[model samples]
Target: MARKIIKTNPNLIELIGNLKDKSYNEEVAIWKDVASRLEKSTRRRTEINLSDINRVSEEEQTIIVPGKVLANGNLDHKVTVAALNFSKTAQEKIEEAGGEGISISEIIEKNPKGSNIKIVE
Candidate 1:
């Protein structure tokens, strides 16, 4: 048997709803994928660090993280990162590197079709 996910955060619930709606309306698989990822329990969700982002990303790329972004290391290039949550230092580091750290809903609003968006774990 499978367990049902019980998300407590109202903001998260809203984001997931928006993601599903966007995916259905726009016929975009990426949004659906992100929504499923976000539906997981907190312990099962991803926690990516700046170093990993720097290693796998290129300058001026758009990356979406379904979970939280940590500030463990430094970022050397400019990129746009959208995630469900961002640590204070993580947001600061991205800004310091000339990058933008925004929310997933904002990203979906900016790119409804989810064009050229890369999912980072």
Candidate 2:
């Protein structure tokens, strides 16, 4: 049987379209890179392990997870994290560290071109 390919959310699709029209060529290239990644392997669902989250640097634009963010690692730096779902412990830990936990859609809305975004699987 062939695997089904899931489509990205309409909001995300719109964001990608906007990104394509950006004036800055470098930014447009970066956005295209991220969009390309998102387009491949349409599983519809995504999950991020907290252990991986802890490895990211604070200076990064933002971390986005398509599925859920778990609470299995220590978060020492203050960084913005946006995802589809977050564990109870993950939410608390992010807030406790002075970081914002938001939805991926919100992140895309704020930074359509993904200018500094680091996507964690």
Candidate 3:
């Protein structure tokens, strides 16, 4: 038998609910995809580095991490990054590079239709 895991973080629970709701209302799969990724166990969740994001993305793009963003390398161009969480230094570096590091929920609220967004994980 498998044990049921309950998410205790109210914010996270709310975010997931909002994602699913938005997906249903907008008929967009991206929000559902992001929500599912976020529902995974902590160990199975994504932990992406700055270098990977930079390599997989282009300038002025909107990207989703579906997990945590780490400050492992450097970013040269400006972009908008939305993730479940971000390391302190990662957020700082993003701002320094003229980029914006925002939360997944915020992104969802900003772009309800989920247009032109790339998943970086």
Candidate 4:
């Protein structure tokens, strides 16, 4: 059977351009990697709730997501979360929890080796 083609979001494209302009190479690489995965239909589609993020321990390095991160769950840990898209509530919650809600580009810049990165959904 042939696989379905997934289209990249325009918003994501613009965001990537901005990251690149800012010289965030790691984030650009990560975004490109995720885009490729989506195109191939090999990337898992998971909906990450806010509660799930909240439950993560502080020891966890970073939470990466290929899809959007919702704000339905609570976050209590002070870990970093990197995703393609983050809802406004989710962003606020993450910040309120003392954690950083960042884009995949930001995470890539911080960890160029791509070590300790987790795909949340």
TM-score of each: 0.96, 0.66, 0.96, 0.67
Which should have the higher lDDT, number 1 or number 4?
Answer: 1
How does each model score on lDDT? 0.95, 0.69, 0.93, 0.68
Clash-forming residue pairs, model 2: 46-67
lDDT of 3: 0.93
Q: Give model 2's TM-score versus the native structure.
A: 0.66
Candidate 2, residues 1-121, lDDT tens digits: the string is 9865666678666655554555255455655544555555655456666668878656434787756788888778788998767999999988887788997557656876677777776
Ranking by TM-score: 1, 3, 4, 2
Q: What RMSD, rounded to one decimal, does every model reach?
A: 0.8, 4.0, 0.9, 4.8
Q: Model 4 off-target regions past 4 Å?
A: 3-37, 40-44
| Candidate 4: tens digits of C-alpha lDDT, residues 27-119 | 435545555443444355556888876665455468887667899968756878888778998889888888888877677577765776666
Better of 1 and 4 by TM-score: 1
- Point out the worst 10-residue segment of candidate 1 by lDDT: 2-11
Off by over 4 Å in 3: none
User: What TM-score would you give candidate 1 relative to the actual structure?
Assistant: 0.96
Model 4 RMSD in angstroms: 4.8
- Leading candidate by lDDT: 1
User: lDDT per residue, candidate 3, 1-121, as tens digits?
Assistant: 9777678889999999999999999999999999998888888899999999989889999999999999999999998999988999999999999999999988988999999899987
